[model samples]
Target chain A: MFDLKPYLEVQRQRVDASLKSYLGPEDASNSRVTQAMAYSVMAGGKRLRPILCIAGAQAVGGDHEAVTALACALEMVHTYSLIHDDLPAMDDDEKRRGKFTCHVQFDEATAILAGDALLTLAFEILATTASQCQAAEHPKWLRAIGKIASAAGCNGMIEGQMRDIAFEGTVISIEQLEALHGLKTGKLIQASVVSGGMVAGASEIQLQALGAYAAHIGLAFQVADDILNVTGDPERLGKATGTDQARGKNTYPLLIGLASSQHLAGQLVDKALNALAAFDKKADPLRAIARYVVERNR
Target chain B: MFDLKPYLEVQRQRVDASLKSYLGPEDASNSRVTQAMAYSVMAGGKRLRPILCIAGAQAVGGDHEAVTALACALEMVHTYSLIHDDLPAMDDDEKRRGKFTCHVQFDEATAILAGDALLTLAFEILATTASQCQAAEHPKWLRAIGKIASAAGCNGMIEGQMRDIAFEGTVISIEQLEALHGLKTGKLIQASVVSGGMVAGASEIQLQALGAYAAHIGLAFQVADDILNVTGDPERLGKATGTDQARGKNTYPLLIGLASSQHLAGQLVDKALNALAAFDKKADPLRAIARYVVERNR
Candidate 1:
């Protein structure tokens, strides 16, 4: 009986604390860019990627301490993507995480610099983490960093984003939409889990299993998001539903029927659980998260 | 008796070839982001940063081949900075390296993603390089990656950029101007040399000397730019002169005097050369490069 609410709460708090320390105390000399970075990072979310990272480590019998910084780096990368995506030239979104977006809160130039800083800082943290580890552990950290970098880079997330922008206002196939989400949203999520396994010195086979688990849950997470946008109670979600339809954004339910999208999400959760069949009970947190990914109201 | 011109040409060609291969061939499936990245990266420039990296490695008795990927990573980081700085929300420049700026050549969203891809590609290159190294060499590559990341990140180059923007159209002091340039332009320059030395397994004292050499040259490079802006022939520079003053941008020439700025640049070059006193003839390329930093009209 792993009560996921408390488990998630504890993990979210830990991640938040690490993020605050990593960004450091804002001094008078610390530029507005740092302030802008902190503003968005602290705005708050579910800490889903970081939690997935920690769970991956635990499932492999690795100490959570080993990948705490890496987890924070993953969240930073996610936050930077959101900040950039919200820019006037991109999504032009004025709000995120229930707060005014970075561009809306600060000037556009400062927001851009802040996002750039966060992305650069993520790599800085990864390399710095590798430096502090024992010599024997260098390769593990390096491999993890390499995996995360590729997942977040041009051939991965950026390409997905470019595809998303290009396909906007045009009819895209269901396959195309899934492929776009796989690259844009799924790649980082998958990398987060796989990188945690890497940090724990998991075998190649174990890493592959983790990758499979992540891929299923990653898509499930997106499908759930699209469902919530269509069916969620606005009060529980803290926002209006059907905005995806209003913006004509591609979503699982929009491409497929709502019933099929829900069925697919449930099937994805089942597949995600099956991917962890070889692991012991230490994988319970991951199993719980998969269920919650589809069940969460918001 | 080193021929600086031929040597620089050889090095520039090598860096270009490596950059081309690193970005890979464009495919029809390749999104516009990759195309934009290749366009800006392949555009002609002095390739000064990569050359400095190679020179740093050579000064430490390390083969230039050892740092080729690292050198290319430095150039990519430099290119990303230029691309973002030219965006409409930033400098709004229409041209760079005698070609249309990234944002001008491509749409703003594509340009943003292109700059993002280049920046992310750089770290991917660094981690991939570390992963490919022998176990004993892993620490060296990791240390170099850490150093480069911090230099390119918020507390270093980004902060410098923030200050440069914050100080624009203001009457800034000479010390403030130097500090601003030191952060914006100097940190990456210094890191390029220092990280290359790290990659070559230079001794602490040797690394310190290289750092000192880089610091002087970095400032000299900027001072020369200020002097050029005041006095350069537009034909030679391929652009208009005095634009720094026309835009009320802070510069050594504006804060001090043209004669004083020129004298300062010369003094910086001498100091840079003196910093390499402990190095052998292998340091000659670095010496020539330092002299060229101040002497180049463009």
Candidate 2:
């Protein structure tokens, strides 16, 4: 068995350690915001994006340590997104990851600045990582950083967020919903895969294959999330069920029927697994993760 | 006479044109957020940061075109800062540059996304600029991007902003005021100067002098701003006066009194001019700009 849980547990600790070193828990001069940033990121969650980043590298026959910094950088960006998404003006989420949201725990302004700081910190980490790579790989690192920045920038995640807010209380088509999540979540997921391939110095063909795999799973992950939002147990899910319907979000289960939505997720997961047919046993983590994404209740 | 006004006007137009092409007035798919971003930036201000960037490059005899993208990138960053600073959770200002603040013009969500988008675009422009430079200058461009990101990132601008919000409604000393603005205002201003020098491939000695000139003028700029907030005419300033004191913000005038603050600004301009003495006539723009920063009504 691929045993993804053990792998995830080890990588989660590794990511947390690197993040602590990269952005320390405190600064004598600037403790409050620093503390807030470290607090929310350290509070805990599944290190899904970073794990995917590592898996992407391993699938391409690259060393996992080579991508540790990039993996942490991606997680930082994800954390920053959550902090901003929970703002009073945005989703107004009072809790996240089984704890009070950043804005709820700290004041709003601190939370805003913390999110901005974390986003900016992602670039800082990537730039520093670029400098640390071998001279031959420096250009690759730079390109990877740029690609990640583009995915999180206006053209990708931020664009998706704008659409999400604008579509509130308004009817949106299924195609529009696909475009929405594609930008918001899919782009970054794709970037994580592509960036890992770049670190491995993979060929353009290999990168495209990775991209295909990521695209399928990106959609599947969101589909599963929609189903969980409607059908999951609150105690296991760590949040209320039916939040998407309550918010009137255009979700897979909302537009498609619940049974069909589950069916769709399974199909997507199969597509995701098939994208890795070229790889050998080295890609087992990805193979296992694809199935886990569709089957996990939480 | 060092007539910097014509030079500034010409450069302002140049920067605006590049920004229009880089981020057009509208996007067919994402018009709303794009328009909000373009509106605040293209609405027109002095373009002080970008002009300073050009002057910094020119001081070291670098071609202006080499720094054009970097200059525009700085302006985008400056615009983004204003957008975020005026948010409902922050300064809560409803007006900027004699126009309704972004949050007031659009919704708070749009304003937040616009600010986020503009910030992300800054990195995009910088990365694109890196690709256009000479092969030998690639590393320099990458380093420049990192430096600019660091200056604008958590350890620099955002850190300063956090301290700003955290220190609200508290008594602060003059040293604390300088430290606050140093990160909030000084760091980015310093980045603009440093980035311009980096684009020109300035030597260590030349970069140091440029940095000294920037340091003096950066503080002088904020000192001027603090004074104007108390004494400026709202129509001329394009924003309300006395709002700083009303918010109980730590300002130069509040700590050192108005007359002393004005005196300090003049002293800083003198120091800035002295630093540029070693530079040739090409540096006249830097000298003139320093004085203009203090002397201008707006």
Candidate 3:
């Protein structure tokens, strides 16, 4: 009964507006590089990560605007990951979100710098937010920033990326696939939820529950993505469909058959919902998010 | 004479030991990436940034130990930059500091992951330090981390790098060179000094002076590097000599003649020393560093 469409549309608009403000005006003097950055960042996409961050904060009875900077930061990290993942040295995809990837649209070097700039910008936004917050609130904001930093940095997503690249062209065990997804995809999503919780001043128990909710949904989201890549319409997806199998990439669909992947995704959604059981009806958005993760077409 | 060699040696040992302890064990389980991180981090460099940090702290009569984590974080950022710079898509250098580059020794993907890991670890160390510090000290540490994150992030070093790459094989003004070096090299070094000052609880006046001091010396440091790249002994320098020229990269020596570049470096060193005039004898180490910046053969 929870219609997420309207909520998603509103959240998307909020995230997009905030991102525009966060990126600031492009330097006319350095238009070439700055424009390239804006082109990719401002390009339309789902804005799912930042929306999740806003929703997560709201789920914990916190003001969404309070975590706006953190939400923008989460999106920046997500965008940077996509930019790098699409590079020739990595996944080598030419399109992302139905447009030419940063590297393809720009030169490889420009794309690299743009991605680097975006990554650095994420931390800068977080730092600026910490500084602007009330003195009493600085530590918690710093902690949230730290969580995002760790999730995006080497010990987490980057390491997972390495495992992914190394395991390509080779059959990977499901356990390894899970670990890879946990680091590459799960950590950032978990950070998004945890950041919202921190900003909202959620209790330790609530934060832990939110983390579990995020992890379950994060995995479910990836599984769904894998399924879509295998079965979704290329035109609708805005990216190449079935490219995962074509590239011999390890994914949930490859590890488990399509039917099994869908089933696993359902179980993950259930688990994610279970993790939120301790929260009141206020957490309906997060519950809806879990279901949406498995049901989203793109 | 202050006997900087011994001081440098002692600081190097301390940093190395702390870095090892901080990185934890080198086992294959959770440590493959950790070990790769340590391998590049511990492989050793001049540790100039950390030394500068310590000198900045000392100039303000702050406890050097308090700033040690910040110092290490600075070095981590520097190392990560180097690892990424040596990637095939970038500088394509096979050797660094006289040894095989990370990508050459390990696979390119591992090297990329290692760099990513180092960057993340730096933030983790800063965040953990901020969390553990006294309540009043937490903001100071967060500010220090912020300074670092900004220096290393977009609108700073990465922007400089974009310009550097774009300007390659093209005519550039001396001002452009300065801007490029200021962002690419000076920002991190400046952060090192400023973060150190922050850790030492420096007054506003002292922090501003320290920043000025760092800016002067950082520019001088790069000019000195340009000089060395063209004139220094190849064996002592470890990396290839005249790489800038080979790559058609713009540098001080190329922009201005060698003699003018040397003169500019000396002037900047003097400016660096002049910035510390307000400090008492505690600033002597910093003054010594300014002279060392230009006088060193390697």
Best by TM-score: 1
Tens-digit per-residue lDDT, A1-298, candidate 1:
7789998998899999999998865455556899899988988888999999999998999955758899999999999999999999998988776789999998999898898999999998888888888999998998898898899988789989999888888879989988998999899999999998889888999999999999999999999999999999876665668988888888888888899999999999999999999999888999999999988833
**What lDDT does each candidate get?**
0.89, 0.84, 0.83
- DockQ (C-alpha based) per candidate is 0.87, 0.62, 0.61
Full ranking by DockQ: 1, 2, 3
lDDT of 2 by residue, B24-130 (tens): 85545547888899888887888888888988998888956758899988888889888888898888888889999999998888888788878778877776667
List the candidate numbers ranked by lDDT, top first: 1, 2, 3
Fnat by candidate, in order:
0.83, 0.50, 0.59
The CAPRI-style docking tier of model 3 reads: medium
* Tens-place lDDT digits, model 2, residues A33-109: 77778878887887788888888888888955659899988988889888888899899999886788998888888
Best by lDDT: 1
C-alpha lDDT of residue A135 in model 3? 84
TM-score of each: 0.98, 0.96, 0.95
- What TM-score number comes out for model 3? 0.95
Q: Give the per-residue lDDT of model 3 (tens digit) for B1-298.
A: 6767777788778777788787776566555667777778877788999888988888888855657887888888888888877788777889888888888877766776677677777887788778777778877887887788889877677777777777889979999899899999999999998888888889999999999999999999999998999998889887789888988989888888999999999999999988998999887878888899999844
Candidate 2: which pairs clash?
Answer: none
Candidate number with the higher DockQ (1 or 2): 1
Q: Over 4 Å off in model 3, which ranges?
A: A25-30, B24-32
Q: Model 3: clashing residue pairs?
A: A154-B117
Q: What TM-score would chain A of each candidate receive against the reference chain A? A: 0.97, 0.96, 0.96
**Residues B20-114, candidate 1, lDDT per residue (tens digit)?**
99876555555688889988999878899999999999898895575889999999999999999999998888987668998998889998888
Question: Which consecutive 10 residues in model 3 chain A have the weakest lDDT in total?
Answer: A24-33
